[model samples]
Target: MEAVILAGIARRVLDELLRNPYRTIELRSARNVMAVEAALREAMRLFLTYDPFEDVSTGTEGLLAELMEAKYLETRIPWEESDEREVTICRAKVKLVGLGRVVEVERRKGVMLARVRELFPHEMDIG
Candidate 1:
């Protein structure tokens, strides 16, 4: 369940990051496990806003399962801050299913999200 929540947070952060490239965000800046949980709640709220009849009681767990089943995430790696450091400050990468786009992030003690940012062209190994 923790993995599900983290993945959803990563997706949301990735979506936001892609829209505004080069902006860095502290993943847990809202500052706690509840912050990630709140993001999930907000997502459910938005879904309900459009489809009022839809059931959102299951919250993010079902969504996470679907994402995993659909292979929405191509890769999710957690490592020490020393492993990779750019001006962006991310220490991990989460590559989504299509388009090969990737989101880099930093996680502290393997539990809390530290920071995140979109990868630049050169950072992505592109010419």
Candidate 2:
């Protein structure tokens, strides 16, 4: 299911960001930031491509929603470029429409700031 894949990707991104040496940095030039964006885009591509028959567990939707709320991953309409939209990941469902177009999955900025504040409050003054 897309939600499972997305949750996995979000967890990986968070782990990578936390492990990176420049986790405290705010600049986009940081390798971790670029990698996070690239990973998100790739996950979008995967979402657009894959159609599996496995059923998702009831708990996955909650997990995905939590990740989205935490700003780990986001879904949006590509052309409108508006704020994040609500996306429901259906299990074993085929995407009949919009197969030719791309879905936008973005890495949100709040994750880093919130993570830093939670994990390294004393280091906040150093940045």
**Alpha carbon RMSD to native, model 1:** 16.3
lDDT of 1: 0.27
lDDT of 2 by residue, 1-127 (tens): 2211222223333333334412221212223334334434434212211211132222112111112111232335566565645432222211111112112223343211111101123322211
Question: For model 1, what is the error of residue 31's alpha carbon versus the real structure, in angstroms, after optimal superposition?
Answer: 7.8
| Candidate 2 all-Cα RMSD | 18.7
Each model's lDDT: 0.27, 0.25
Q: What would the per-residue lDDT of candidate 1 be over residues 1-127, giving only the tens digit for each residue?
A: 1222233334455555445433333332222234334434433111100111111122211111112111111223365555533222222222232112212223334333212222334533211
- lDDT score, candidate 2, position 44: 26
Our tally of clashes for model 2 stands at: 0
Name the 10 consecutive residues with the lowest summed lDDT in model 2: 110-119
